[model samples]
Target: MALPAPPKANRRAWPALLTLTDDLLEDIFLRVPTPTDLARACVACATFRRIITDRSFLRRFRAVHPPPLLGFVPCWRPGFLPAQPPYPSAPLGLAVADAADFSYSFVREGKWKNSPWIPCDVRQGRVLLKCCRNHGNLLTSPSDVELVVCDPIFRRFVELPPIPDDLVDNRRFDLGHLLAPTAGGEDEVETSFKVICTAANHTTLVAVVYSSVTGHWCTAASRSWTSLSTAVPLPCPGGSSIFDYSQGYFFWMSIWRSSSLMFDPIRMEFSIVQNVPKHSPKFPVVAVGTEGIPEMFILSDDSFHLLHFDIAKGNEPSINEWQLRGTIPLPRNCMFYTTLGAAEGFLFLHAIPSLKDPPDYCLLDTKTCELKKVCGNHQKRFNRVNAFFGFPRSLVK
Candidate 1:
């Protein structure tokens, strides 16, 4: 009792978390391992909520932590397959899935009540969807449909203004992507985005981009398919619903030709990446390399090959050449079916054991080269699934 009475001054000097400045609090919160944990901390007190909700703090946090892959959203149906136990991010993913609206009910309100919206692409917590009559094929042309960009976690959406008639009159919409913001401060990155839609006619391939900053659509690039490249035949954009983004560029494996189409968003240019591997039946999925270069993953019967494209030195201008990096053997008895999607250093694939057996879905960690089965024999329930990945930073707000 005498000793306790002597230490009253020391007890009174102890620091309180609430007394810390916003700057110091943010410094501590940035170390949160996952967005789900951060979301939980947000409700601890009013000060924690205010500091985490700040736009500046959110941007800094994202920079420190890469977005977590929640789950795959089936393109064929309005449902989500949450990552379950055994998956590293399963717990965080399940929380996000429970909180977000994959049904897209927010877009069905008011005048668009009866309209059907199909998920086109998902990037950075935002879903890109197009309103169309047909929902059977994910690769159908979206030339005449209205586009909507929504944050499903927050249940807010913005209906983009129609692309000008002159820009898309006779062209067929091939592929559309929700681009990550490249410039501006945190507010712009959080609120502003661009949608790049590619369309083609008999003679020309045109790219029209709609910017949220401008609230208008403009032609980004237009070139005759013949002039773009000679090594590959005309591209069939409707052939596959698979595309990948890396290093400020978007890539689509040409189904009709032995090449891939590359789009540079910064320069608004289209070029051909020739001499890519011609793996039939299944196309290689592109993932960003550790050094910022692009790498492709090709799946075969027994193993999957990793290929990297590097510059070939010569008198000629720099051209990307695909080089075999390594190969990872698949589990015995598993046969490759088709590539479902790729994101966040993981590739999703469909596999079947035998002709009579049901298909199994697997996820490949590109870095660790570890393959794990996610779901099995549900092909009848969901025809095709595209993985939708992001950190739910906006969930707090």
Candidate 2:
């Protein structure tokens, strides 16, 4: 006779079959890499989300990858270009601030024909690329968008669609992009990037955003004429470009006065954030730093305390407030970092032990104030280089 059934009053092992607690299953899920994969694991248990938390993992993954990078070589060189303020050329800048602290400045490179490249801090782990002035004829338009998206660390690049010429004023070129996930994703999919630009001409200012998911550009809110009166007009608005994918917005320093006046790259907004410089949001330059987390240094030259702009609320005069934070002032010699994205708990920087030549690549730890060298073949190092360092490799999804 066949053996009696194991269930239905005689024997029961159903509880043991599903004995694994939700927390236990969740812990197992976190180990898997990839958003799509993690998502599937999350579906297995409500406990998985609590443990692995899809968006949380993806975000941390984005921050750690630390995107800003430069992988550009112009088709043709420019005749001549200007530097400083209206910085018509390279935006080669070195940042001493992290997401938390917000004071930044663009370092002017000495060489003009070096094909300078600047690292854009958008989408956290992925870099939005920019190159110095190229041949006018080769360039699509005077205000043409000349940025590309590529892996900062790997040197991989992708040229993006040019910005509409009519929208850009050509008087000033201010660009920023925010990386955010779109609604649709099945199994494996490319993450979406939201590119935002604010180009202000003599009397025209337009805000535009590009959706990587839809593969097309869309108009953001219009420029407010109310603030336009007081809004520092071009000619010398030294706004530093920044892209925050986490908050679904891009930011820039619209005007650089005593304190750097900042603007939002997305939603076409502006604000004043004085949270940096010798006080709160103060950043000291450190070496051997990671990309996402940057060590900041308040320079003696710039204002003792610098203010960052925050325009999160959409419409309103950028509040004038400088929250106090600690400051770091390092010897000019030690304050070397790559002008790129922050990641891996440090700021990627370029430093030259001797000022006679270009600086060597180094990493500065933001949290611990540690410096470590990361450049190899220092002699053949990348020229006009910007960085997007520290992001972990596993979290690209």
Candidate 3:
């Protein structure tokens, strides 16, 4: 029996793998932070690549891992419509920057080859771009606008169906996207997304939804928009929409009413989140999360202050009271600024320089209260801040 103890290789194999079970291997693979890193790991061996590419494994990875701060997409465009043939062509492109370390790059793809695409909203790691090619003259003819949902990280896009004739002719529509998790544990990067176009159909609000599951568009009927007029008097024509990931609500800020238009994608219902904390009229911005999804900070009194819209506590049906959390100060005289975006307890603020100083971008950590300069004149010239947040990484072919 002792002489048949077996080869040395066989004895070491069992002990070596005792601590590295299938579950442990999957956990180690999920901890890879970026998609680029994940891709690199796949090349190590065929077995690892197969596990990473598995549909179930991808779902579990995304569920367990929190998104990391990638960079900001700065858009530079004069208007939503392309200039006439005789006019000079406009400059439109997306600038990608490492807001943490100040590294930067630009995404120049065929989608924006000729005309600039207006970035309307960012959510679920995708940006909604409105193609400005067919939009007719603002005064004379109806605009034939087309919407596109883009994954800037992957440099890919999916064009949505054209808007209805009436909705385009009337010129009253807003776009938003929801990248929900699929029930079947499909690849997150390939499928499981919905685009909603809210248009003012005469006196009512009609939403056209496009689902990746069906590969087609459908209309959602709701009476919630009937009373939306009281909260948002005029629909935001080609404006940005923000979604609350944890609470599952889309928010549209109403400049006229100084309130927020909240839409529940599940119920197809609309409600108003009113009593937002007053902010600077010059550069009003809302950073949706400080510690989590419930706490939000708005730039007020030339500083970033925390507030919460407690929807569950209020007795009123329409408005929820905003509770103050804390205040975050800025560099002296750096008052005029806009909040580009937020994620993982960080706020991206774009400071507008006065005549004496230069423009700057900064990253603020809400937890540690540390402020760091991400970009300045040395990195790149940014005219506008389109999106600044954590971009998710997924393996989708």
With a 3 Å backbone cut-off (N, CA, C), the pairs that clash in candidate 3 are none
Q: Residue-wise lDDT of candidate 1 within 1-397, one digit each (tens)? A: 4554454445466665576788888989999887878999999999999999887787788778877666777763566777777777677678877898988888755334455676777777677777654334444454556777777778888888877778876335455544443443654645677888886656777888998777889998998878866443443433224567665667776344467777777778777777777654567777765455678878776777788875222212235555788887877766445677677667787777777777777788777777787656554545456666675324122
Best by lDDT: 1
Q: Tell me the tens digit of each residue's lDDT in model 2 across 193-242.
A: 56665555444455677765566666664554344444344432123333
Instruction: Name model 2 segments beyond 4 Å from true.
Output: 1-18, 21-23, 29-143, 146-162, 169-190, 224-255, 259-268, 273-297, 301-324, 329-348, 356-358, 380-386, 389-397
How much lDDT does candidate 1 score?
A: 0.69
* TM-score, cand. 1 vs. native: 0.80
Ranked by lDDT, the better of candidates 1 and 2 is: 1
Which candidate model has the greater TM-score, 1 or 2? 1
- Model 1 alpha-carbon drift over 4 Å, by segment: 1-25, 39-50, 109-115, 133-142, 171-173, 177-184, 187-189, 231-241, 279-281, 311-321, 354-358, 375-384, 391-397
Per-residue lDDT of model 3, residues 82-116, tens digit only: 11222111111112321111111122332434545
